[model samples]
Target: MNLLKKRWLLLTAACVINLCAGSIYAWSVFAPPLAERLSLITGTAVTAGSLAAAFSLANGIAPIPMILGGWINDRFGPRAIIPAGGIVMGLGFYLAATAVTPLELILGYGLGFGLGLGLVYGSSVNTTLKFFPDHRGLAGGIATAVYGLSSVILPPVAHALIETEGIEAALLTLGGVFAIVIVAGGLLLEKCPDAFAKQFTAAAPGKQMAAEECDWRGMLRSTRFPPMVALMLCGAIPGMMIISHCWSLAKDVVGLDAAAASAMVSMLALANVFGRLLVGALSDKFGRLASLSGALILTILATVLLSLSDQNAHLLFSAGILAIGLSFGAFMGIYPGFTAEEFGAKNNSVNYGIMFSGFSVAGFAGPMAMNMLKEAGMSYQTICLLAGTLAILGLGFAYLFVRAKKAAYS
Candidate 1:
């Protein structure tokens, strides 16, 4: 009863942090205001706020905190880290509501808010993965998938809050939301008991060891780690292109109406959530290596089809969403399971952070490079084709990794 109670609490907290991260997927909602703030008026084809730039930067650069957060959790445990992360993150939102200038908003949302996110998100997968190692893939996927849904819900709610209550009130309201998530969930998030671990990981067992187990530098230098990180980077590389350009591509090439274009984005997120849960569960049954490799192959096909989707009705829409969602959710689904399987749970929190930077690298490059490439006369289709090529290459890497792992174990 006591351990179950603790898990309920911590899972609640993990869900909260995951939701905040997913809320980033709602960057489109803020683009208009941010654009206006940055002198990129809505009427202008390109907005000045560079919403994509700021969002990607904040999300990418922000992963730094995950390293520290994971380290803290490993040393002292989630009890100290999560609540502290929540308190700090809550304050960032309180300040964000008051932001007026572009620089101010960047600091508020980009740096400060980003920091809070980094702190909480750092531990989300690590903590939850420990709780349900049998379901690490599922557990981590569901935690991240909440953010997918967060994008769905927060945008409309945020709009309502901003319209009725005003931006300041909206900020304050969201701060409260973050506070609820942090406190309610934070209090809930505690270390899993050995019994819980036993029940969860009956088949794929875990070891109870010191909080500090792996050296990040040592992990970095190891041959085993880099391939996994590279696989993630390859899987994630084209995500920015799809999300940032989905609407424009739909309108410009596919000739979809505005309503259709909007629906497509929503469906994409919905598919992503589905992929996360389904893939994660399958990984638990099959193996992380198998599940992730299949996802990569699927992603490669979808990206290629999406690139040339000039007027395939919903095909472009369907393909693009599936690809983005798979790639987006795959990391969350795969990383925790992979790390736990390979490194032992004791070191998972810290080592995963170092590996997680592959995501940050994708975040930084995906948006800017996609846009820059398109502007430089590269067709979105052609670029997507290139992404497909990379995806195939990623699948090859995954194959090598799996083969090598088998050789080692056998």
Candidate 2:
């Protein structure tokens, strides 16, 4: 296929494959069922917070594969890693389907599936960024957007499947389907060819006008990297909490039914999808730091609103959900472009991989706090208040990053 056709095809296929990996976001739907099943088997009560820890643990384990996978992709390209990820992910889902204990669930769904997602997600997003150097934000956004979009599409389907076919069957069916789709998409993925790369590179000004290219080691040495990582860590906390525990919060705190809570997940996901696309495109125009600062501000606002709203105010609750989801999606959307612009694209897979460890930290911090707090009988309002504080901290780091970038460039 021609280079132009290949790029577009890669984007389309990557999006579809990410859709499969995105099922991780639908974990809220699975949590109740998995808990019930475990309860039946072990004759012990399973709390929602315990299951959320599994979700957080999955994200915590992700950085291992993300870094390793990105390093491999840098050397050998994405074809092998992508399909390998699919196989691992499929195995994980299958194992989770048969799991009867919390530890088993964590191993299967948390560690195994997270590893696969890290590999696949990093490869797909990085490849797309490489292909469109001039439009890095838009390209990365388009690629990552589908991952968030998957939350919108998969939850309802998973909920329906859980209701009808049962959770085990639902997991089995999804595992089988995702394995096929991801493998097929991997086969279609190709790095940008030399000719295409040169064409895109040529569009930018001479070296003086382009951003400096820094290797991972060099990037680490830079003053900007630390604050940037901190920003990502803090920025991720609120989103992680919402994605993993929002369903329970909605049902218990908002007084919503199971269906409404499920629908709320979809609603947040829809907002997430739009946020990715819109933030990415907007960053191209307004600049990444500015856009990110704006998003972080919104994140704080959302958390505060969510904390204030209660069971009686469903509309306000939904609005809070939308805002938080959008800010989360926007953060993901901006990251690839931000990383490339700040460090350089040549080592992006690994550089971003190193940076993505922030998500892992957030993963541990967010859910663990929620689970611990809930176990201690703390109100959900406290979680929101803490998240909002973290968002403020994130915004501060963002400002430092912006100043550092300016000092370097100027």
Candidate 3:
């Protein structure tokens, strides 16, 4: 087959593999059952709060392996790294299934699964970007949208499995499936051909061409890097805050019952998927920074709406959640292509992994800020207002990023 057809096939394979890898988001489904099982095994009360550390560790430690995986992908191609990561991820699930204590669960799911997720996720995204230099935004959008959507798709299935087969069987069954699918996808992937970029220019018809190649170190040294990180952090904070607490927020602030709150979570996830696709395509036509700036503006509006929402304003609450979801998804969709455009695709695997540190920071900070403010006797409205203020600051950082990009690139 021709290169065009082959690349498209690889893209399909990447998406399928990412679907399995994205099962990390299904942790919410797993957490409760897993906690009950562990409680039974250890003869102690294992609450979800007790497992929060493991969840935090899982996310916090991923960047380390992601950086290593990206380096390997850049040097050795994705085939080996993808399969290896998949195996490790599966092993994590298997180990978690048999865990007798909280520490074991942390070791199994937290360190093991988190590390493998970083590897597979980073490799899949970077490989997809490498093949689609001419359509980076769209390709990135599709890849990440699938990843984000996995939560919606997997939760119901996982719940059913947990109900029918029990937690251990459910975990084992899912792990085996993830391993087999990822390995199959890995076999189909190949390195991007050297001539591919030359055959199709690095930009879409009206978009600016990509910058010259820069390794991770060079990218870090660039004047644009700091503001770029700040921009990502700013965009991610409110998104993470809302995402981490959406169900609770729906119940507490909007006065929804359990069922209605669950529906709101699904709505936010759908909006996230749509945002990724919409903004990603728009970035191709308009520009990455412009798209990101627009998203930030949406963030500001969303948070403001959220601040004003009360028990009587369910409609406003829903709208706020939808807008935040879209803006967050836009940020997630735009960054991979944005990083490639600014730094060059050659080192994108490592470079984008580094750029993702901003996200990791936001992940920790957003939730911590929310919890802290709540503990300080602040109302939900006060917290929402604070998030809106942060969005405004994010816009300032976006301007700085734009100026830095011009000064560095021009």
Candidate 4:
């Protein structure tokens, strides 16, 4: 179907697959059903936060396979694996749907599904970058933006499936649908048109033109990396906390019941989509550090709102979430864009594969941080306050980076 001819179709597929691959954010939606089915609770048999932790761990660890996936793509091409990921991801969901116990949920959805997600997720960026090499940021922005949009699309559907058919049936049906998608979408990923790769690599000027040429060895040696990892961790905490505590906050802080709380989660998901795209494209205009700074400031404000109110919390929460989500989106967009801008995309998959584990690291850290805080008798208010403060600290780091950038030029 001449996918390149219909660029829109390709974009749609990319967006769909990307977003769907990211539905890991929607893990919270399953917690209620999963918990109910197993008769567990937050501090009891199971914690939604812990499950989220597991998912983040998987996502962080995803880059490992992505590194391998990129190598495979560079060799055999992308077609077969992407779709296989989709199928496996679906099966993960299916496992979640069918799970009667925690073990199945962890192994099936967390491990198996996560592996599929990792495989396709990184490839999507690599694929989109190749497709629109000229607009790498835009491609990465939109495709990467799906990180949050995944939550927007699936959690509600998952919520409904849980509410309607029960988790088991939902798992079965969704898995079946995914099996078909994997087979179909995987086919399109088969080959990178030689013209595209050739034209792309040829367009670069010197060992200096595009920031995409480097051996994996050089990439591993860069000392400029730690700050980037720090930026990602700082950005991830509150955003993840919001995700982990979506329902709980809506219930406790906002005074919403289950249905209403879920609805708010949906709203957060919607905002997340907007945030990812907006922050990313904005980076192209304003520069990466500025975008990061803006997001950090916004995160601080959002956390403030999050710390305030009960039933009257909705409006403030909305404002705070917008900032938090956008900051998060920016983080996703900026990291890949920054990596490519700094090191070049030649070893992008490999470098990012290693670096990308930060997400999982954040995922692991985020929940543990929050849970520890909570267990230490820290209120959500305390956690929100600290997370927001960290955002400010991140802003300082971004400021320093910008200063360094300016210094290099002068």
Candidate 5:
């Protein structure tokens, strides 16, 4: 049909491809089983805690490949880059299936899978943002919401597969499926036309203003970049901290049982998905900065609620968890469109990838801070209060970001 019709098809493909690539979030399902298999094979004690370094590597190394993938996607279009990424991801799983040592697992799943994930994830998001300039927030929200939802949806299926087929066979099966879906989806995508925005403007008389194009180098040099990164980091820290330790918080601090603690995890994931969808649409109408400010407020309030919550106050604890999930999801949803709006979409793939480095930093800092403080005999209440203080500082940074954006763009 027409190019317009083709874009919708491409959007569908991107969603499907993202669904597969997002399975990386379900790494928790594989961790214990994989660790056990490694222990048996290597005749050494391989705890899940020991295997966590590989998981950390998988997340920590993604930004490097994302930048590289974004560069390729910007130049050559997503069609080739996406399939290539899928192939590498599949190869990683294949290698992981044969791993006899922790190093091999790290190389295969950590480095290899992480590299492929960065490529595919960046391509899908960039492509979606390019095609839907008129609906960037909603488009990005849907893309990331599905990505976040993978952890919720895949865990049960992955657990079942591991139980029946064994970890190696399950890895092989899932890897093959992920590759086929991503490759097929990639084939359906095409680059956005140069005049696409002009066409939208012509069709809709009162649409948002056309974005000002800025290359990656110019974007990095801009006055707005630093504050924007700082705002993102601040917004992300509480979410990362809560997500990494929610189960422990639920169990040890809130005194939740096994089933209830598991439910808290599911609730957080669901809230995350809802937040991505809701804040994304709302930001389109309410403005990104305002929506972000609201999210930060919610984060601060959540932290306070959590700090005050105890075993006798399950409702308060649940509310705190829900709020953190929503606020965190809002940050994830807002940033893609916000980056494009601030720096422009022409170089968005690379620019957003660079912007995402803030998230990587938050990922490490949030969890490490929580773990260290807890190890040093700090109370959960004290930790939550500290997180709240960080959110307050983030709110200040958000104001700085707004000011910087206006000064630069105006």
Candidate 6:
């Protein structure tokens, strides 16, 4: 195939792999069911928070494997590692299906799923970035957008499986299908050609790129890195919180039934997908910092509105979902491109892996905070208010980064 065709194929394959890998996001659907099942089997009450630990722990554990996957992919191609990720992910779901204890659930879903996710996610995203250097934001967005889209497509099926066949069957079925699809995509995946890789070094006229061929260590040494990490952490917490706990919130706060809760999850995913695509394209047209600033501002507003919504105010709640989801997806869409712009695309796999550790931290911290605060007698609105505050904190970092960008380009 020609270069353009090959790149497009690779992008398509990456998207497919990500779609399968992102089954982890459907944890909201599984959390209540899994908790109920465990409670029934063990004859003890189980909290969604306890089960959510698996999800939080999964995100926490992912950073180590993410760094490993990136380093390996930097040296070797993605074919082997990506396929291995699929196998590992399948094994995780299989384990979850048979799990009767909380520990087993944690090991299966937390370590197994998290490790597999880390392995595949960075490789897929970096591969796309390498392929479309000129449109890094759009390319990265397209890849991650599919990951977000998984939430849109999978929750209803998962809900149906849990309702009809039970959670075990749901886990087993999803696992099997994901493994096959991811493996196929991994096999079909390709790195950018040498010609395309070379073009990445060539910048548009009068556009001064700050970082060029900068290694991870050098990138870390720069002042910009710290603020970026802070921005990512703060920006991600609210979204991760919502994603991990949305079902519970819908049931408890919105007083929605199972079907409605499932619908809420789908709505969140739809908004997320829209944001991913829109934010990436907007960043390409505008600037990454500008796009991030706008998203963060939106997050702050949406979070407050969500906090204020009562059970009767479903429309207000849905609006909050859409707004928060949009900001969440926007962050994911823009950050890969931002990493490449600031750190340098030459070492992007490793650099982004390191930068992504912030997200990993946020992912875990968000869920942990929610569950912990809930246990401590915090209201849902109180938690959301905290989340909104964090978004405000993120905006501060966004401003700093924008200033830094101006100084670099000036």
Q: What TM-score fits each model?
A: 0.88, 0.85, 0.97, 0.81, 0.96, 0.86
Q: What is the C-alpha lDDT profile of model 4 across 99-125, one tens digit per residue?
A: 666666777777777788777877767
Of the candidates numbered 3 and 4, which has the greater TM-score value?
A: 3
Alpha-carbon local distance difference test for all models: 0.70, 0.83, 0.88, 0.68, 0.86, 0.84
lDDT by residue (tens digit), candidate 5, 129-178: 88877777788888999889898899899999999999999999999999
Sequence-dependent TM-score of model 3: 0.97
Candidate 6, superposed: residue stretches over 4 Å from native: 28-51, 159-170, 200-210, 241-262, 307-315, 368-386, 403-410
Which candidate leads in lDDT? 3
In model 1, the Cα lDDT at residue 361 comes to 79
By summed lDDT, which 10 consecutive residues of candidate 4 come out lowest? Answer: 202-211
Write the residue-wise lDDT of candidate 1 on 281-368 in tens digits: 7777677777777788877778867866777656765776677777667666667667766766766777887777787778667777
| Segments of candidate 1 deviating more than 4 angstroms | 2-9, 34-54, 193-213, 406-410
Deviation from native of the Cα of residue 202 in model 3, angstroms: 6.4
lDDT of model 6, residue 304 = 84
lDDT of 3 by residue, 1-410 (tens): 88776888888999999999889888888999989998898888998778877778878888888889999888788996999999989998998899999889988899878988899988998898888877788889888999999989998999999999999999999999999999889878888865677776534531555667889989989888888898898899989888888998999998999999999999999999889989988898888888998999999999988988989999899999999999999999889989988888888889999998788999999988999999999988889888878778988988888788778757
Runs of candidate 3 exceeding 4 Å displacement: 202-206
Which one wins by lDDT: 2 or 3?
3
Runs of candidate 5 exceeding 4 Å displacement: 202-207
Report how far residue 28 has shifted in candidate 1, in Å. Answer: 3.3
lDDT of 2 at 379: 82
Among the numbered candidates, top TM-score falls to 3
**1-410, model 2: which lDDT tens digit per residue?**
67666777788888999999999977888899989999999999987668886677677787788888988876677897999999889988998889989889888888779889999999889888777766776888898898878877888899999999999999999999998899889878875553455555433221111267777899999989988988887878888887779899899878999999978977887888888898887777777777788888989888888888788888878888999888888888989878877777677888888887887777667877888878998788778878889889998898888788788868
Worst 10-residue lDDT window, candidate 3: 200-209
- Candidate 4 Cα outliers beyond 4 Å, as residue runs: 1-8, 25-61, 91-105, 159-167, 190-209, 254-259, 308-314, 399-410
Compare candidates 3 and 5 on TM-score and give the better one: 3
